[model samples]
Target: MQGSNWPIEPIPNEHDVYFRVHKNYIVNDGPYMFKPRAFVERGDKADQHKSMSTNWEEYSTPEQTQSEAKIPMDNGVVAMSVGGLRSENLTVNHAPIPTIRAHTDVNGLPDDIKDVEVRVKLFKHCRWVINPELSTNP
Candidate 1:
């Protein structure tokens, strides 16, 4: 969800926070984790120095654990993998929730549909933008 022109808004919900991104552009990326410039590894051999001394016998991989943990994601996706099952929790960020473009029908065509206000939350980094629109009034 990067490299596009769109604005993002963050709205607080009763249980969770909602993020919305404008779909005016063909591509976008944002709400991403930002690692400082010094922490970034570069060049083709950047990953060659990673530590590899962990003992496999004493460590339990995520696949062996039955606990459910929230998978960190960019662009407003709440992904999770638990008990060997991979599930995706999609919010308004991943999809282009409809908005009033002056005037449009329920199917997105110009018509007499009522105009409604939308709220959203997002983050930006570099040339990327993350957007997620709220589907309901809050």
Candidate 2:
């Protein structure tokens, strides 16, 4: 919300990349769209939207497409969509094939927003932080 203490969304993912990493998975580039400022429409009454989504379409519609889609998501996931890509043809340079998965116990999120409950790409940055940890043998 406008008054929440949440810092801010990193930035909306570019819609044309065709492929980009999120939680270590090289997902379809077109579907990696991101939003910075989202607001749920007044009409939206779905429990899912009230809990996670904040976009107008998310709230104004009946039976959101998200419920029926096979898109993988987090407990509070609010962004990105998996529109089906040919895994055999897509390749990610550093990411392991198959899928890159993560389990979050609110590990790297702002504590204030954690209780508020919003889906985000926090896994995106977690991966970035891992390079240093892995690169240094220590």
**Candidate 2 root-mean-square deviation in Å:** 18.6
Q: What's the lDDT for residue 23 in model 1? A: 30
Candidate 2 residue pairs in clash (backbone atoms < 3 Å): 18-29, 19-29, 39-54, 40-54, 44-59, 76-119
lDDT of each: 0.20, 0.22
Kindly report which residue stretches of model 2 are placed more than 4 angstroms away from their true locations once superposed: 1-32, 37-65, 68-104, 114-138
RMSD of 1: 21.3
lDDT of 1 at 115: 19
Listed per candidate, the RMSD to the true structure in angstroms reads 21.3, 18.6
TM-score for candidate 1, please give it: 0.14
Best by lDDT: 2
72-113 in candidate 2: lDDT tens per residue?
A: 221112322211111212111111112211100111223233
